[model samples]
Target: MKIAVDAMGGDYAPEEVVLGAIEAVKSYSLDVVLVGDTNKIKEVLNRYGAKDNSHLSIVHASQVIDMGEHPAQAIRKKKDASIVVATQLVKDGACDAVVAPGSTGAAVTAALLGLGRIKGIERPCIATPIPSKKGITVLLDSGANANSKPKHLVEGAIMGSHYAKYILGVDKPTVGLLNIGEEASKGNELAQATYPLLEKLKTISFYGNVEGRDIPKGTVDVVVCDGFVGNVILKFGEGMAMFIIRLVKDTIKSSGFIAKLGALAVYPALRTLKKRLDFTEYGGAPLLGVDGSFIICHGSSKAKAIKNAIRVAGELAQQDVVGHIRKSIEEEEVEQYDSEN
Candidate 1:
């Protein structure tokens, strides 16, 4: 499978991004098309002794969508931007998927405009995986649509379920709507109206509502909400993880010799904990409900994050996630129509 890499989309573009593509090519043995300024990309490749490799190729893109620029406007005007060209590669079937560690909005907008939404999908949402007690939990609408309707939540649930099941390897993954309380009637009008629709979905195991505290507790496999709330939860969780880790380290350092010894004893465990909390461990978030597979990495992503994002894109494409989502939505629609009639 051929994957297109956005060589000029992240904070460390064309350096870390190129190295990550090289690592992915060597590890996965897949063709990688690096889309960016060809000369700069080549320089990075040569610096890392990766130039003249058969598995790697470069496609020139003249412009770049700066992080500060407006996503929609940049996508429209900068047709040859790295992110736009990478997405177009997928739309034209020149690549199996597009992986970019760029501006999240630009990636999402480019995908929507270049590839379009999947059949029967109202809106595309970002499905991001968070580290949880049981291993990992999939959170959807993570900053994709700041404003969403009841139907949008229902779609997120369906798409998130498939992702949790196929990608996260959860059997019959239980989905929960992120809310103020566990009760069905506790949230806003959107959550209240979405509860029944989710309950009706036979494809997923709907577990009612999940509070913010339940996220780290691994209360469910998939958490569904509008992008506004989901994004807040995601950022808060990441910040909390960092805070706890730093707190532990500071406490150990400032304490007496006994505390230092204690910390030494738990150093291995702490290392494991760090890995669990690292955002790079989960790689990138997948833009679900879109026509083509797109993995949107963090803006500050390094080589490891980019490599894992490419791995994720490859896995989703192999699993035909978009196809499964379309089928699931179609089945639900049919069931709803028949029952109403």
Candidate 2:
């Protein structure tokens, strides 16, 4: 299977994007198509001594959609932009999956308007795998569809549960609705409305309401929230992790001689803990409910993160996650309707 990457769309632009494409090509046996300005991408590849371009190829895209541009309008006007072209590749069957760290809005719009969604899906949700004390939790609507409805939250739960099981290999992944309290009647209108729908989904292991505190504890496998709330939680978790790491470093530096010895003693454990908390370790977020796998990595992602994103794109494609989710939702719908009668 082939994965197409937009190599001109991130904060690092051609440099990090090209380096990442090359790293993915060298590390995996899979074919990679780098979509961007041919000459600039080649220059970056040459910088990394990536001369053997057997597994790597480039598709020229002259224009670039700025991060702030209107997604739908820009996608239509700038037909040759890397993100648009990479998305078209998936539509045209040139690649099994697509990766873009460029404009999140543009990418989501391009996929929805271009490749379209799976049948029966109202909107595609952004699902990000977050590291937690229990291991990992799949958080949906992480940064897409900020304003959502009760049905949207229920859909996110279904998609997130499938993602946790299929990609993360968690069997019968327990689902939770992110709320202010674990109690059944704790949330506002949206959560209250979505609660019954989720509880009735026989295919999923619904665990009722889960608060923000339950996330890092990994008390549930899948956490469902509107994009607005999910995005806030994800960003807050990232910021807190960074702050704690910095604080730990400062504490160790200011510690007394004996305390410093204790810090050194647990240095290895601390390093492992720090790595587990790093958001980069999750690679990227997938745009679920799309016709094909589309992963969005961080705008500032370097070669390693890009490489991981490509791997994620490949794995999702190989597993046929979109097809599985579509089938699961359809089956659940039939079951629910039948039981109502």
Candidate 3:
């Protein structure tokens, strides 16, 4: 499969992005098209002894969407921006998927505008995989749309379920609504309204309401929430993970000589724990409900993160995630229509 990479999207644009593309090409045996300034991308490739690889190629994009720029305006004004060009590749069927470690807004906007939305999808939501004690919990609307309706959350649940099933390999993944309380009567109007809709979905295994504490416990396989709440939870969880890691390291360093000797004994386990908590390990989140597969990585992503993102894009394409989502939504619509009549 051919995947397009936005080499100018993230903080370490061109350098780390190019390196990651090379790693993906070697590891996955897939062709990679790096979109960015041709001269700079080539220089970076040559620096890392990555030139002359038959699997790697470059597509020149004259402009770049800065992290701070307005997403919609940038996409409209900079028609030749790397992010837009990479997404366009997917739209034109030149590539199976597009992977970018750029501004979330820009990536989402470019994908929505370039590829359009799936037929039955109202708005595409970002489905991010969060590491939990039980396994990986998929969180939807993790900053895709700041405000969403009850129907939107229902769609998120449906889409998120398929994502958890296909990408995370969860069979019959249980879905839950992120809310203030576990009771059906809890939460705001939107949550209350969405609760019944989710409960009625035969396509997914609904687990009812789930509180914030349940997220780390992995009480449910999928958590559906509006972008406002989901984004806050995502950011807060990331911060807490970092803080805990730092606290453990500082405590270990300040301990006595005997304690230092004990540290070596547990170092391997600690390293494993760190890897499990690292966001880079999962690569990136997929913007579900879009016409084409688009994996959005962290803006600070390095080579490893970018490589993983490409792998995710490849998996989504091979698995035909978009197709499954369309079928699921259509089934739900049919059921609704029959019941109404």
**Local accuracy of candidate 1 as per-residue lDDT tens digits, 1-341:** 88999999889998999999999998996888999999999999999999988999999999999999999998999988999899899999999999988799999999999989987787799998988888888888999999888888888999999999888889899999999987888888888888888888888899999988777889999999999998998899889988999899899989999999999988788889988898767879999999999999998999989999888899888889999998998988822432211
Which 10 consecutive positions of candidate 3 have the poorest summed lDDT? 332-341
Candidate models: Cα lDDT each: 0.89, 0.85, 0.91
Report the lDDT tens digits of candidate 2 across residue range 202-241.
7789999998888888999999999999889889989998
Candidate 3 regions off by >4 Å?
334-341
Give TM-scores for every candidate, taking all chains together and pairing residue i with residue i.
0.96, 0.93, 0.96
Instruction: Point to the candidate with the largest lDDT.
Output: 3
lDDT of 3 at 38: 99
The Cα RMSD of model 3 versus the native structure comes to 2.6
lDDT of 3 by residue, 101-176 (tens): 9799999999999999987788799999999989899999999998788878878999999999999999899999
Please estimate how well model 3 matches the true structure, expressed as its whole-model Cα lDDT: 0.91
Model 3 scores a TM of 0.96
Number of backbone collisions per candidate: 0, 0, 0
